[model samples]
Target: MKKKLWLTILVLLMGGVNLCHGQSLNTTAAEVADFDVQSATSNMQDLKSNLDEVVSQLYSLDEKERGTDNAISDKYRATRKEIVNVIQTINQTTDTIGEQLKKITTYKKLMLLTYKDIQASRSGMVDTKQYIEDFSNFIYKLDNKLYNENTNTIDDLKLMINSDNIPLTLANDSLVQSMILQLNDLMNNFQQNEETQLETIKKLNDLKTRTKDTIEQYQTEIEKLQQKKNYLLQFMKLYQNDTRQRQLTINNFFESTKGVYDRTVELVKDIKKWVYKVDFDMERKITALNELENDNEAYPLAWPLYPIEQIQTYFGDINFQTEYGVPHVGIQIKAGQWTPVYAARDGIVYFVADNDEIGINRAMIVHTDGYVTIYQYLKKTVIKPGDTVRRGQIIWYSWWEPGTRGAGFISKGANLTFEIFKDGIAMDPFEILDASIVKDKEALPDGYQIKYLRDKYARPIDITNLELMTGTTLAKRENQFLIKYGVGVYKQVAFREDAVKDTNIDKDMVICIAFAESTLGRYLSTNANIGNVGNNDRWDRVPFTSAYGWARAIPVTLNNAYLWAYHTINQLSRYGNKDGNIYASSPINWQTNVLKCLSQIKGYYIPEDFPFRTGPNPNINNPTPETITFGETLTQ
Candidate 1:
């Protein structure tokens, strides 16, 4: 019995020793695995940061070129090339990391090893410090290399700029002109390069396959270890004569193992957070670069629509006969019913409405470049006055209308009226539109050849309604909103109210003018029934204009408002105080100046006796002092 007892004790000791050894091996593996993952994550992050810094530096150099001498511009170009090389290297590294992540099975093995090391540590096992040191050194080397490369690139840039025969393209132009162009070009290129770098960073951050798989594997292993530990505790308790001793050992093991698992989780969380930060930062930088690029004078047009079809009429010198025997100044095109009308350029919808009152449905867009386009006789508009429309975006649709006079004209069906203006003066649109888009059609009933207009068709009023009614007031207040919504009825009021306290203009005068023009929103009728009265076709008349919740008016009316305001300001400045103040005693001055402004503005809209009407018309009612005072309060 004594011999058996001794043998049993020996066997138990041996078993414990074997378990400890195995656990130690596993622990070592786990630590190595953890180090590998962390190393890769850190390397990728550093690479991304370095690339971002390079982009930022390049942008700065480009900005400097704008005001600097030709020598400085040349220096910037050379530095840009070196930075490009560094970017290429970073991209290569990112690709390597991505490839490694794809082999998830290997990563899983590494994770398992890390878990084992943690388990072994609980048994008082210790790993060599050399492993950790080696990893730290590896990361340090990469960082150092990146730093040196960046420094060299920057120094080279400075040298190039200071050297003779500056290689800058700006050196070829007049000194000042060359510098300006170089600066602009640099800014554009910098933005483009930054965007590309951001795309690459996004790709690297997206590498999740291996990481996810490893996480899952660690979870499975942890569960299994927990079950084993529980079983061992239960078995030891049952066999030990001294329960306290057995309990203490089991508790210690539990604490140590849990600590290891917890630490692993924390590391993973940190890596994820780093990736998110890097990604967000890159995005922000890209946005800034884009804004900088847009500030250049030769900035490309925001809207660059290619004509889908040919123009049927050219703007200017139109010979169409009106009911009163007056000739028109705009051109007209024949198109298929429901054909999409696109903005000729990125601009605000100036007017959009059914021409029923005038026997046509049309849409118009006003550009920041002082150009305006009109698309007449539309079935529907898809954009609003204040909406910032993109290039080539469909603004409205066209529909067929019956011809009033000639035989061939009647067969033409749907026709589009197109017009262009520069600072309120009508100009031929053919010069701006690409000629290849125009198609030749049969001669008109009036024995005239169809003129092909080159400008893009503007959206009529229906689309403007959609834009104004779709969003909250706050969203509509953004700069993009101003670009989309041109100066129209409601918008005009908003603009005036906002500008009332502006030192540039008189608040009372602006309010009075708006009241006279639109009756402070009371006279403006969006309901198609009351506003559009001429054509019976719902799609062809103002009555058919979209009743969107914001401002229900044709796009053309807003355009006219702009024309009116421009003329009003121009004429008023000629007579009254050019300081923008209007006094009660200045009524006569206001009237005279207003008449002159109207005469100028009306030239584009009407050609016959435009300044003098045949019938007697009453003067616009002036606002009382009380009403004007209240208007001032609203602006305040």
Candidate 2:
């Protein structure tokens, strides 16, 4: 019956304990321990009662001997006194044991509570430490970015701050607002990041303080419990070793409740296991902020692929519309048909899927930036989860071409699709990787036409949404392989002579820009948006009557009139399209691509391992070759 009662009591107490942990641990471990100890009070009382009964019987025998002391009073007076004294001493021992058991129960209660409290303290400590590390790393990266930008542009920033670009009237209010929006995006993100760091620190400090206090409290309770237990154990041993019968009875009692003792051992074991198993999630909490304020593109994370690679597609902006849904959340970089992709930073590989449902192999590695990088469409991957990789280790190689059924066709041909994620939220990889390194506008084949450009793009018939400009303006051509303009004819064929006269803008720059803009006069649109130098915002065109008219308006006329003077304030090197997307932030890729293409235009070089030589996609064969490598410079 007592065993059943103990089990019921223990079950209820444990239920409350589990409940406490679940519900923010509103009830402290101390409280729950005290409640459980109450169940044993009745058992202790019963044991005391039996002890008292045994002592009372010994007193009754002594009293009976005293009753017969009339005649034998003189003779047995000493014996009677001895019996009374012995009985008195026996009663005192019983009382002492009763008190000791009371204290023992309290000590046991305390030890149980201390065990639970320590686990809680440890959990809080680990959680707080992880959170501190996460926030620190995030804030450090943000600070680094700010330092880089400020150090480089402190003078320019000061000048801009002092300059009076504001309008007295509302005529240029929108323009000023747009400029503010562009600059403030970074500042606001920085401020928010700092505020998050502050909040994280507060949380970390509170948790640390709580953990420390909990440990101190548990230590005090345990010390008290241990001292009391030591005294109580010594007191109990006196009765157990008093006589053979007493020893036998105590032993039997212990044996009877042996199951309860075993259960308690198991309970302690369970709590130990829980302490080991129930780990707090160490995921970075600053992940959301990282995505929101990814203005720190110069985060020192190198590109997975370098100079030859180009970012074919960007994050967000899927379906060519900015309405809703981020279907494509990362960028794709084309390194070549068969080139190795490197790790962005030093980290461990966490996922590797070979011949997955996507048909292409893929790998995901956790980078030091607290984000996971996924490289898909891989032909070969060597590392697996938990394998450490260096910053520039070749983690995988790109496939020959995009998977037929899986990824289908990558925009810039056989390429590696790279993605960065933090706590399941996808981040823009280009924010860390150099977008220009992967996307050099100048690395295009000059004097070459992209064949099957018609087949590659959907026909005008499928462009049902072409509402404003709906008329069919089919292109005309004389030669399909070489330079061919539409039936519209040339308005002004003054490209080479004009380019030579304007020494500030080289022929190579002209050719590279023209080729890169619209695939050497064959854009995706059948209308041939050859000179993709249209509206600064949309790149939408005022359609040209002839290719020469388009070239004359942008490259020839625009350069001569305003842009191409090397000594002038409006140098073409720093000049971008009308909207001012600078082409010279990091000019290695641009200069290299342009110079290489210039060599090709001069029949100077060609790579034997070119992928597009004989397909419907003809090589830009306007007498162009790949004679020069990137390091070579063209002397003007």
- TM-scores across all candidates? 0.22, 0.24
Q: CA lDDT of 23 in candidate 1?
A: 14
Global lDDT of model 2 = 0.39
RMSD of 2: 37.8
Query: Best candidate per TM-score, number?
Result: 2
lDDT of 2 by residue, 331-430 (tens): 6667554465677655656556664332335666654444667677675565766565555556676654322212222222466777776544567664
Per-residue alpha-carbon lDDT of model 1 for 269-307, expressed as tens digits? 443343322223433433443442212211222212222
Error of 2 at 12 (Å): 99
Q: How many angstroms is residue 181 displaced in model 1 relative to the true structure, after the best TM-score fit?
A: 82
Candidate 2 colliding pairs? 310-438, 311-438, 604-627, 605-625, 605-626, 605-627, 606-626
TM-score of 1: 0.22
- Show the lowest summed lDDT stretch of 10 residues, model 2: 608-617
What's the C-alpha lDDT at position 116 in model 2?
A: 60
